[model samples]
Target: MFGDTIAAISTAWGNSGIAIVRLSGPDAWAIAQRQVRLQTGAPLKPRFARNAVLLDEAGEVIDHILVLPFRAPHSYTGEDLVELHCHGGSLAAQRCLELLISGGARMALPGEYTRRAFENGRLDLSQAEAVGALIQARSNEALRAANRTLDGELTRAVGEIYEELTALGAEIEVGLDFPEEDVPYIADESLADRLEVVRQSLADLLERCSSGVILREGIRVAIVGRPNAGKSSLLNALLKESRAIVTAIPGTTRDVIEAVLTYRGIPLRLVDTAGITENYHDEVEAIGVERARAAMKEADVCVWVIDGSEPLHQEDVDRVHELADTPHLVVLNKADLPQQISEASLTALIPASTVISVSAAEGLRLDELKESLVGLVSGTGALDTGLNASSRQVEELRGAIASVGTGLKALGDGLDQALVSGCVGDARRSLSRILGGDRDEDLLHEIFGRFCIGK
Candidate 1:
């Protein structure tokens, strides 16, 4: 499938100024030349853009375009590549792609371009995955994280430890094979120390994996409270827009109203759930209340808004009690009004959770609340060393850490040298797999499957 020249509309299809039709593989230039002719009738130059006239099979004009050619071994897929800069709309690019396909270029599969780049030694597995992350990033932080990985920051870090493990494994193998030879075996203490260092490195990467995943996939925050508790007001205040319907009447928002915003470069999906109350106005209110509960359970953090101006209700205390095991915050809203419920009292009820007083109507002390929300994501403070790790990478790191630990234990216990050598080999293989050393066809398909076509 990779041997066949592949073509795809790389740019978005719309009535814009320009769209890109991309082709890559051995016959990419030939396929594009068959569909387009340079205005000056000169041969296309490598790494240079030339004005071209796109023509149909009958030699009739299709569209005026700019053709950019790239020679093999320097292109994205390390193959001959061509890009047609055509007028942005459905018709022109579609016709150009059809012509290229008819000229022996097959339509590219989803993520096939990036997959080829990975297979052709242009990019490692992690970097290739980052290309997909870059496209799907929801916030600046996510984009930066993806950019770091794509820039080979992750590959460099993993490569350092992988090389170290490889050297250590070699030394251990020599010791095991030449036990009776004059070559001195590495002292058990020295081996333990070296293994400890590698284990620590893997553990640090493992620690950062949670926040890295959150950076790629943003957090979901649910705003939950009883009726007339300024739940919708808090959502609107955080969003800086009246996204949810706000009114003096209770239960104005009868369903979940969600909005996404960037808070300190973090993508936050805020869900304003309907007021939780058993005293329903109708079946709709009951359904809304149920959905609010579901949202609370699914959220990364739940902001339990309490009206500070009003005395505490049974529902408030009951909800607070239920959040004992969940990660939540106590937000006492209506701070602009004369206070009736003290922060001290709310703190006493939920001592583990942070209590912040804010007027969602007046937008008071919300920054502190936002900071608390950001805190819910673990290991976000460390981003300098390529914090982002895909689920597969995370699992591999864990396995490597475990293997290192097992090797250290074997050395300490004075067990067979073969066991220690086997553990070291296992750890090295795990790290290698992360850098795309052992090719697993099924794993490749699953990872690239998430990407959209033409990437």
Candidate 2:
């Protein structure tokens, strides 16, 4: 799969000023040269752009294009590469791609170009994974976090730990080789101390993984409350648009309406669910109520909206009790009108949750509400640190931590040097896998599969 020359539309498909079609592999240059007629009628120069007339298999002019060539060992894929910059319309781009394919380049699979780059030593697994994260980032924080990973922040950290483990493993191996020696290659206390240090480093990285994953994958915030509690209004205000229908009708939102927005650089997925009510108008309302409950259950945080102008009702108390265990905030909506529910009374009802008053209808106190939401998710402002990790990376870090713990336990139990070394070796391999030093074909496929083609 990695041997064949591949090509795909590198830019988004649509009407625009220009679109890029990338071709990379051993035969990339030849395939591109076959489809292009150089204006100068001379050989194309590496790393230089040349005006060319793109030709179809039938020798018909498809489009006027600019050809940029990249030589081997200096290209993104570490192989010969070429990029065709043609008119942005689908007709011209598609025709040019067809010509390239007909000339011997095959369509690249999802993330295959980047996968080849990794296979060819242009990037490691972590950096390659960051490419997808960067493309999928929904906020500036997410983008910065992904950029940090792409710049080798995580890779360098892992590399440092891997080196330490390798050195420790070598010391243990030396001790294992000379069992009869009165003095070991590495003293037991010194080995245990070194392992403890490595364990602590892994522990710190794991500590950052929670905020890291949150930054990479935004938090899901479900807006749930009683009927006509201004759930839809709140969604509209947060999104700064009328995304949901706001009306006096109790069951206006019969299903979940979700939108993505950033709160202080933290990506937030606001989900406005059907108002929770004891009475059902019909089967549809009942289903909506059920879905609302499900959304609250799945969400990382829940915004419980209450009508501040109305007296506290039994339904409000019931909803509060139901979501008592979940991470939630009580929103007193309709603050623009006369207040009927006292903040003290609401706080007493839900002592564990933070309470905020706002007028979703008038867009009052929304900035404060957003800040509270950010605080709810980020306990220590770790998102500001710009660190990020994927679930796979977190899992590997945990595995390494566990192995180090096992080795520490073995050392404490006066186990054989061989057993301790074996544990250390396991930890080393786990860290190595994070950077693609150890091969895991299925894992590689899963990581790269999330990326778009021509990446």
Candidate 3:
């Protein structure tokens, strides 16, 4: 596949100031030379941009453009590469790409360029994966985490553990080779201590992976309460938009409304569900109530809104008891009005839940509420912690952890060197998979398949 030249429009298809169309492989220069006429009528120089006029197969000028060339072994994908900068618009780029394809360049597939870069040793699997993550990042925290991975933070961490395992495996091999040697290859206590250290490192990585998954996937927070308890108002206040209907009449919102907002750089899917009431005026209202309960069940955290201006109703009290085991926040809304419901009384119902007072109508203490929500979802105030892991990466790390645990147990139980070494090999392989040393074609296809065509 590397023998054939490939081309693609590397920019988004839209009217913009400029669009970039890229080509890479041995024939990249030859194919581009046929389509572009240089102003100086000179051969294209490596790493230099030159004035050019793009021509169609009919030899007519399509557009005056700029051409950049990169030499082999130093460029992205470690191949001869060319990029054409043309006037923004889908028509110009599309025409230029067609001309390049006609000149012996095949259209590149989704993530094909990045995959070529990986196959050519320009980037490791983890860093290549980060390229997609960085592009898809929804928040600054996620962007920074992906950047950290791209910078080889994850690779270095995994490499350290892998090296230790390799060393342990070598020592076991030496013991097996020289049976008559009086000095032990690796003392049982020493082996156990080393395994413990590696296991601790894996544990720390897993902890970071947990945070990364949350930052990547985000959390679902459902705002649920009885009718007229200001549930829609709170949702509007959090999202800074009137995403849900609010009215004096009960059951105005007879369905669920959802929107996404960022809190402390962590995405929060805020869902405003219909008011939960025991008695419904119609079947639709009852269905809405059921949907509200379903949203609450699916939520990572529940923001239980309560009418602070009214005394606690039996319905609200019963709902609180129902959400006793859930991670929740008791939000006493309408605090701008007289406080008829005491915080002490609310706490008495759900002792483990955090309670906050906010007037959603006035936007009072909304920032504080946001901070509390961030804390509830992620125990830390900052989302970027210098590491990030995708779901697949985390699973592999967990496998490494499990394998290390097995090795530690074998060492602790005074098992033979063969058994312990086998466990070490398993752990090493697991870590290797995370580092992209393991050649799993299905896994690579799945990871790279998420990228856009031009990447």
lDDT of every model, 2 decimals: 0.87, 0.87, 0.87
Question: Per-residue lDDT of 1-455 in model 2, one digit per residue for the tens?
Answer: 36789999999888999999999988999999888899996888999899999987778888999999999889998899999999889889888888888889999989988898899998898899888888888778788888888888888888899999999999888877865556678988999999999999887766665566788787899999999999999999989999999999899999999899887677788999999987988999999999999999899999999999999997787877778787888899999999999778889887877889999878999999888887777767477565577888889899999998998898899877788888899998888888898898998888888888878
Compared with the true structure, the alpha-carbon lDDT of candidate 3 equals 0.87
Report RMSD (Å) for each prediction in the order shown: 2.9, 2.8, 2.6
The prediction achieving the highest TM-score against the true structure is: 3
Query: What TM-score does candidate 2 reach?
Result: 0.89
Give the 10-residue window scoring lowest on summed lDDT in candidate 2.
Answer: 378-387
- What global local distance difference test value does model 1 have? 0.87
**Residue 188's C-alpha lDDT in candidate 2?**
86
| Clashing pairs for predicted structure model 1, backbone only | none
Find the 10 residues in a row with the least total lDDT in model 3: 379-388
Off by more than 4 A, model 2 = 58-60, 180-192, 207-212, 314-325, 406-423
TM-score of each: 0.89, 0.89, 0.91
